[model samples]
Target: MRKRDLEIIKHLEMFRVMSRDDIVDLHFKHLKNPIGNANTVLKRLVRDGQIEVSTMHSPYLYFPVGNHIKKNSTKIPHYLKLVQVYKDLCEIEPPTEFIIEPQYKKGLAEPDIYCVFKGTPLFIEVQNSIYSSKQMEDKIKRYELLKQSELVKPFPTIIMITNTRYAIESDQIKVIQTPSIAHLIHKANEDSNTPPPPQPIKTNGNITFKL
Candidate 1:
């Protein structure tokens, strides 16, 4: 797949699952380059089975090849930014799923980027600020509480992607990765046996303010 293609899918997979509006929102995120390409790529991925496509017509439903979406502590618009980053990374491997809005009552409240790498649930947060420390810690605690669920996994990481640093509760259980958008896009893919195609040279979007 092209780097852009992988990136788009990476973003698509971030939702618990997505509807048509979600896709349109993403179209602005990564597919402003041209027309028709988004639909074409979606069809191809569905045929390849790397992604799941649900035909709801008025609101198309799409998901990664998984049965369910995971947990996160972000809203949809906010999470889309993080998802874009993950998509760039998926030029090689699928980013583990993350839910920005943790569902509760259904009992999900640790809304960070949670992943099971090597059998551990690593919860990551890309923080641009420390003003929300206490509330963020509460989310971590909720993660621990929710880990008791047979459906929930344990082990978490709360990454803060920031320009400045601040203290966080050490007792709640978390780890931090400092701000690094290691655009290793070319690097990560090159490391893989399969390298993603080079991004097409372009300059049109530089003159615009995208949503």
Candidate 2:
């Protein structure tokens, strides 16, 4: 019934599931005894039928009431990763908008996350496992098609986070392949700060000024 409790439920509804630590870190970390406080509030929610808990995983996972996802669903880990990604981005700089698994037109791109950070939109693909070259190519092609369609105006830059680097290039849309969002943002900042390469001096008989 507290404000933070309501926000936790909202987060569950949006993210589908979150580990106990994730909830505590995001909501109760300000308290002197964060874990204890979180446990108390979460237990009350579970007792009142406001949320569901899965004890199968250590540091039990919590889900919104009426959630259809099975306790053992393989997608549980994937969603948890998204929650971590969201948390990381928040630490760097909170995103103005963040959506999970944004749906696009049929046969178009299916981005894992669509977020606006620092006034720029980004479509992120969190690859927990290595994707084959062909699979990567197919994914890029879908984004190209989506760009051509122009449904999402000011098309977002596509960022692929994977441990196994895949050689992916796209002219229609900017693509950044990195292991994490922090790396991507840091690289972008570095690139922006880098000075332009020196231009070659053109000497037409009497011209000696820098071009």
Candidate 1 residue lDDT tens string, 92-168: 45545545545544544545455543344555566544557676667556665665553554445555555556565
TM-score of 1: 0.44
Report backbone clashes per prediction.
Answer: 8, 0
With a 3 Å backbone cut-off (N, CA, C), the pairs that clash in candidate 2 are: none
Question: How does each model score on lDDT?
Answer: 0.55, 0.90
Clashing pairs in 1: 72-99, 72-111, 73-111, 73-112, 74-100, 121-155, 123-157, 127-161
| Candidate 2 residue runs with Cα over 4 Å from true position | 186-211
lDDT of 2 by residue, 1-211 (tens): 8898899999999899999999998998889999999999999999999999999999999999999899999999999989988988887788999999998899899999999988989998899888888988998999999999989989998888888878887778888788887787788789999988766666776545453
Error of 2 at 59 (Å): 0.8
TM-score of each: 0.44, 0.88
